[model samples]
Target: MEKERRWTEKYRHLLQAFYFAFTNGYARGYTNGMIFTGKSKYLCVPGLNCYSCPGAIGACPIGSLQAILGSNTYRISLYVSGMLALFGVFFGRLVCGFLCPFGLVQDLLYKIPFPIKKKNLPAHNQLKYLRYVILAVFVILLTSLIHDVTGTGIPWFCEWICPSGTLLAGVPLMILNPEFREAIGFQFFWKMGILLVIMLGSVAYYRPFCKYLCPLGAIYGVFNPVSTYRLVIDKEKCVNCGSCQKACLMDIRTNQTPNSPDCIRCLKCVSACPTGAIDSSWNIARSKFESRLLSEEENSPNPEVTKTTLLAILTIIAGLATMVSTFKYNLDGVLVYHFSGLTSGRGVLAYMLVTLFKGIVSFFMIITGYKLFINRNDENAVHRFREQTRMILKFVIIIVIAGIASLFADLSLLSVMFNAILICPFPIIGLPLLASAASSTDKLVQGKGSAVLWWIVFVLLAVVTSYIAYISTVIILAG
Candidate 1:
């Protein structure tokens, strides 16, 4: 029995290693620090393996899902979604236990000698719900709802959250690609902070991410109750000993619930059952007596943070992106690259504000271009192109009108409402002026003190820039 346990453990690890190697088999790409943009890239791997990983031959399902959700067309990733549903219906968290490379990483991390290991985290039950929140917010809501100028949503999970990509894909690419390394900034460090916390947490707690923060795991776990393969307990042979619970690393009370959603099908509970009551099964034909013995009441399970922290983190990320845009825009240089600082003291403060707004636009443009490019051949590229074109036209019309008005003011409109003052404040001032014109009050803008303050500042700066331009033009004419 002990040998069986050992052999099973070894087999799971071996399978994990082989699967990881197979998913990331383009060793030469790793050597050259390149991504494999081959036919196999169309396939989605059933793990959290990164598509951007140098050696990865297949795409990560979650990333693929995000790309589709965040695209201009906002189409569902049928391929990725189908793959996930298929995997979930069949395997559930078995992938977490035996297939996910990140899962294996956490398993290996736990094996390293540690002074004090915890059986369960504090508030483990409630905390487990966090993965669901992440799935809903980062993976779905942010990716689908919040869009940029290009009508492309950002993959908020990959951009600001995923530690797996940071550790597995980001680090290796950073080591290989000079340009990628150069682009690394606060975003990279923010990801590293998340990664460090997961690594340290895993050392003390088993599979902390799989238990709590993994959006993929949360998705798979939902199918566990209905999955084709499942863990079973024979009630006739069962003596209600706590041995199974003792051996189960997931803190699952298997005696009451043999097929708990959290169960990774590690088989520890099966191996530890003194009466040999626990077993893995596919609901094959069995005698009525045996079926009754396996059956128990279905009633079971357990269930159930930082709004300010999230706000601060998001603000920091936004500020960093804005900062990067103001001076040297690395985002495909939609326009001028270098510029004076926000406090350059030339009454050109609107330029700073414009750059901030530009950065915001550039983020969407950059992400949209990336998503469209990456998933172009992978999907209906034609639909995406059309969607983007329509969105661009709608925005361009506004910018054109703003441009004409700004030309009169000798101002560079960057704000959207400029769809008044002009090239620079076109979008920012767009809604307010339009709304004010219609209703005599921009309720949304007027309701917020901060919004009102920023609007005042923008107008004052624009007037100053117009005066500067007029003076310069007059001097040039006189000369």
Candidate 2:
């Protein structure tokens, strides 16, 4: 355990966590040994992880992008793309640096003891835009072409290019499940081979896939110039030591301009700065607040107000529980059975209510997303709302469309209600999980009992659902 605390070891732990998420979360089959349904069921990992991985806790943004792009609606992937652009604007490649597990893997690989050469690699930067091209071609153009020809929508990337999918979901599950092993074909081998090559190269180059091909990175990079948390160089104070340039993994020379779309906000340059001139900050308020707190000797111990400590604790518990539950179902042989209930068409009302609730949730999602777009200089709520709601009419169409789709799906009352409650936690899970590795709580570790209560609620719900399925199956068998 003591050996694990080394920085390299700690970073490797992050890689292990990343590996665990991909393999155990997305790739592994359940205890029931079901096949992955190819639905965009898992959440996007914000980096390069593919959506088809059964073990994923949340949806893959790229998969969502493709689905929305090639949806039955045939509308452009405005919401998914908008979300990506919004994240980019707020954090830029900061998502890749701090949030992406795949990037963490690459970082771990780069730490190996060997002679390393650093170069500008702007040629590679140009290729970063290729993800946008892939989004357009595979997601939109090819999806449209294939569907038009065959009346079936296919995710070409999941079938072909996504190495994260193979690394995290494919190999582990195939090894564990005999059924999965039998199902593996030439295509699976092809994907594994491609992923192997990428893995080998990743040991040498730093995130070749990210630099040359991740659409999510391209989308986020758009937000780099304007993101609140960014690298700030005092042009007046830069001594041209060029150390900052050498320190950057993204090959961005911070002394020249830290505003490059390629900048990952890894803080290597900030830490390496000799003049103490570089200052990396999240927001004006946070930076100012931290500066004041650091200046004061007493505030150093417990910096910042304890305003959202409860919220943070609740969030952590919810996220951790959800991750564990999702992983269990995907990996540990959980069975999903369809049940018929006494309530039927009346279920439509339940679905309607759920749909309404989902719409409201999307409203908050948009509000939170757009709030990031507002200039930090602006303080008035009026301006914030105005800037956020400029495209309200378009989003009205989106909400109505989503509502209409919900209304039409053939689902049960209990299922619909369950879906609504399930949907609510997603945004809550998303914002915080993407922000930090662990929970954002006080870390003083109080009120753990309340968090346990939340877990109990979830487990009870799962158990009840399982019991219903088992009973229904037994009755059918007896008959």
Candidate 3:
């Protein structure tokens, strides 16, 4: 029982590592050495999994980000960046300590009886700054700049550095894939050498790459002091025996500064402090009194008011998400990317205008959606509805124009059919707008006939557009 209770979050670190590895285990991809390009590719994992690892089910955020930042299509760039920030806010460098597969590999390597001269590296302080430089120049600046003839820049870190790519993706793929082996060059060997050196160094030192090379670590480290979940020192309980610092692999003075950026949040310091002065917790910087006050304030809201507030919040959030995905994924960006063959400067300008119009419509949506759901504006409801309908339709005309523009991108029957779908990013937005324009959105949602009418209108528009586009393309080709 004592052994089981020795560590407060026992086996959690190992469990997280195992969990991520299992999730990334696409066993068939190893046999084929092909990336799993499913819908999960859009869901970037928090840890630094390789972009092209055969077994990876999700895309690496950093690698995918380089492509997105370099290309004209940044449909999911903001979304991925937001995910990275969300992770940093909650866990900071705890990702490095446990979640990253590469980090786990390095940790296992360290146990091979190759201890360094000291726990930390020589000139560790100065060497640590190298990661920030790599993060800025190699990861961000080069990926955004330094383009080739294809109008996309080199992902410099992935091309020249990044041992994770080398070890996880490069080595396995070369062994498994004949076609991939044909493309091998000096660059592959160079990356392999770096990976070997880092592996050996992990045995000699503690995570040399994380300390001096990993841009992701640099990015997450910046959030350590500010992240919602982090370490704290209870000064009242502190005997200042310096046990925490002695146990720190990163050599952080945990008693003096518990939330240091260099700290990987391993929780070893918490275990080392015999006084139990060290702690791993949420909102760690806040006082007990402050937390209690926040708790009280949160509970003070009546249940009905809390429920309504939650509903309003959720409605606005849904409306905003709908607006972004509608513009970014369905209607505008797809046509802009696939149909760029025919779409020139004027088309690009039109797209920009359409995107701008989306923001206004989104604002109107959240306002009207919030008001409609709460049964507000019962006074002169008809006039308000008429005004919202006019405003919304006017903006939607630009969207219709965007869909129509897709037909010009290509004259193929497939293109025509896709244009119909783009034009109708509808049915998704349709029912909501239909309800929002009514005196009572709630009642409209309840009305089965109203929903049926909306679907009919949607179908009619798609069929009519498809016929017109196909006929026009046929006539033009004949001419």
Best by TM-score: 3
Q: Which candidate, 2 or 3, has the higher lDDT?
A: 3
Please give the TM-score that candidate 1 achieves against the real structure: 0.58
Query: What TM-scores do the predictions have?
Result: 0.58, 0.54, 0.59
263 Cα displacement, candidate 1 (Å): 1.4
Clashing pairs in 3: none
Model 3 Cα lDDT, one tens digit per residue, 417-479: 344335434423553444343434333333676566545545644543564465457547857
- The C-alpha local distance difference test score for the whole of candidate 3 amounts to 0.69
Ranking by TM-score: 3, 1, 2
Best by lDDT: 3
TM-score of 3: 0.59
Where is the poorest 10-residue window by lDDT in model 2?
A: 329-338
| Steric clashes per prediction | 24, 21, 0
Cα lDDT computed for each candidate against the true fold: 0.68, 0.57, 0.69
